[model samples]
Target: MKLLPVFIFSFLLNALAVKGQGADTLKRPIAVQLNVGTQGIGAAVNYGVYEKLALRLGVNAIPIKANDVFKISGFNSTSHVSADFYNIHLLADYTPFKQQPWFRLVGGFAYFLKANGNVRIIPSDDYKYGDLTLTEDQIGYVDLNVDWKGLAPYLGLGFLKTFPKRKFNINLDLGTYYLNKPEADIIGTGILTGNSSQTEQFQSNIKNYRWLPILQLNFNYKF
Candidate 1:
């Protein structure tokens, strides 16, 4: 029995060691970068920690809203507008297709800051139809779990190039997030003599299974 344990350990170690890095592989650049992208562009810092893997951390905003969803039927019109969200992500990317120019894939996880969320339903109507409105003041923080919901998945693809002369690399990444369409309650009022029923339960359209592409023009300092 004792010998079996030792043999198993040895076998596992040998399997890991069998993967070899050829001379050209060793020369590949290791890098660190600061990047910005859409959905409230932000700065992210990442460093190559493995043969073709990078660890990253970043923060982005979730400013979401509908162009127009309200038109007071007859005498008044109602519009439902959403506030925004702050999302922070931590992820790892494997540049398996790094050497290629046309393709690259990156996937990871994110932490959404929901406690600092603000949901306001603004009704833009005439003073006569003026009613109550809601802001961060009312439903300041959601009554549900914000931390667990923060955990999300991330995916990205892009074109990459390494400039030997400049000694740095540049790439453009297009990515999106997979979020569990958050279901939260929003209570607000428009400071008017009337109220709108449209903005009442209009939280369903925040976003559903959608890819909000973010184009990142990033610079990487290779070592």
Candidate 2:
């Protein structure tokens, strides 16, 4: 993690030493980008505010579900897992060196409208209490949920030029968002009711999961 910033800094210094043309000559300052990354698929609009600065507004969303992916030791059970994340963001891209406009310093903020994860576990085996087989509902199940929704600040570096020399270009973004602290809950039914007591412990264990890393590719069209 520490090496990333150092590497970018070194590259920036090298870029500053090169001589190149500026974007001031371009007639079209507006662009649109289609993006995909850890934040899922999204689209953004970009506008150059000055020779060295551009602003972007965009939205992204991710919804995923899986079955039988989570398991417990010494237990025969089926698990369902789901995660959803949605956000709207505004970002600024600033080129510090006139000669190397390809490298940019990016700062932004996102409002996560929905960020939640859920897991449900159910016993998959038949249990007997002295020759009496227990039914599925009698065996019970457990559900664990966590949510991190609200404003998150972003900081990172951008690679390649922000806009195209002609009509199209490709760029990359490397960054991370500092998400708000999450709220967690555990709910259990029937025999697993006692599991709800562990909600506090679960929240404590995940208290530091606020850093959400991002690696995205953007396809840009200058209009």
Candidate 3:
């Protein structure tokens, strides 16, 4: 329900006696998720904290197309919106009906690092924060650039296996939030609309505003 300012995640740290598995019914699966391209190099590690639960930590950089963003805000606005993220998550996995379609829900908390950008909407040549000067071009073209860099929550769904032996657990998750309620930011309610209050302008930065869908492919080595 809240986004913490920082993320500290540990890998599959449980003691698995059977080569790559746990001694009993428990196991810690240390893994690495990679981005197929050079532009997106996101990586993460997950753990098996409980039979029906897992936790993870990851670091990723997600950037929106400058031209696409410019189309929405004209050429004068840039978003300092939180896009670059260093996050950690705690998830709850449940397999209610093991005979039906393979389904799992992962929910957890994470810290959103302040986004870093090169297109400036805010002029930075005149401002200074912690020993660095920012350019307006580097800030992009949005007026309300607010970053929730402390804490945030995420939830996603994925598949554990297909048919028969449940060979692997391939997953795809989308974090379920933009920012905490009542918080001030340049998205969601913070965005103003004419004619009506029903608008979808703040999806790119409030919480789970990934530039692209988060695709995770995992290989479970069990004993």
Q: Go through the candidates in order and give each one's C-alpha lDDT.
A: 0.50, 0.85, 0.41
Model 2: residue 19 alpha-carbon error in angstroms = 18
Q: 2 or 3: which has the higher lDDT?
A: 2
Q: What is the lDDT of residue 182 in candidate 3?
A: 23
Q: lDDT by residue for model 3 over 1-223, one digit each (tens)?
A: 2232122122112211122343365544544444322124555555555444455565655654443243333333333432354454444444334464467655555565643332223432354556866554433333344344556555556575311233334454533533343222332221122212221344243445333234555444322
lDDT of 2 by residue, 51-102 (tens): 5667899999989899998999999999999989999998877788779989
lDDT score for candidate 2 against the true structure? 0.85
Q: In model 1, where is the ten-residue run with the lowest total lDDT?
A: 139-148
What TM-score does model 3 achieve against the real structure?
A: 0.48
Model 3 clash number:
28
Model 2 poorest ten-residue lDDT run: 15-24
lDDT of 1 by residue, 1-223 (tens): 2353354345334433542443235433445565665655555666544444555677776565664453435634334445455678765555555456346556665666742333333334324323644553332321211112555566776566422225576777788766656554444343431333333344445435234456777767665
Candidate 2, position 29, lDDT: 82
TM-score of each: 0.57, 0.85, 0.48
